[model samples]
Target: MIEKAEGTFESVMRAVRGVTRAVAAQVDDLVQRPDVLVVEFGVELSAQAGAVVTAAGASAQLKISLTWNK
Candidate 1:
């Protein structure tokens, strides 16, 4: 049982690390670009019962919502 739980935790951590790397890379790319607008924020949860889930689950999301003048 302990071994199975450890394996699961390791897998989850690996996934989280991968996601963090991808996000960092994307943000770096946007930073290098001149005409890139990035908006990021986190959700503030007041109270929760059992499982109150939201989109991305209170994460830091980057949104590029801008149009270039052609």
Candidate 2:
């Protein structure tokens, strides 16, 4: 995982610097419990290398959980 700010910035730039991207995302579903909530999303990222890119492909999909002490 990219832990530092500089590394994170570079990671993002590397994906975008030389590629064309069509990005889409949707929240597909969620689960709720007494103490927490979780949500999952579907994401589609279509990437094609531009003239400056040698080879590149990228997509991101993730789920998040939120919780609070009662």
TM-score winner among the candidates?
Answer: 1
Q: After superposition, how far is residue 37 of candidate 1 from its true place, in Å?
A: 14
Worst 10 residues of 1 by lDDT: 51-60
- lDDT of every predicted structure (CA atoms): 0.47, 0.42
In the range 1-70, model 1's lDDT, one tens digit per residue, is: 4564455556556766676677567766763443544444332322245432321133234344433454
lDDT of 2 by residue, 1-70 (tens): 2244345456656655333221212222323333554545443433354422223344555455556576
Model 1: CA > 4 A from native:
32-70
Report, for all candidates in order, the number of backbone clashes: 0, 0
Model 2 — which ten-residue stretch has the worst lDDT? 19-28
Regions of model 2 farther than 4 Å from truth: 1-54
- Model 1 CA RMSD to the hidden true structure, in angstroms: 8.6
Structure candidate 1, residue pairs in collision = none
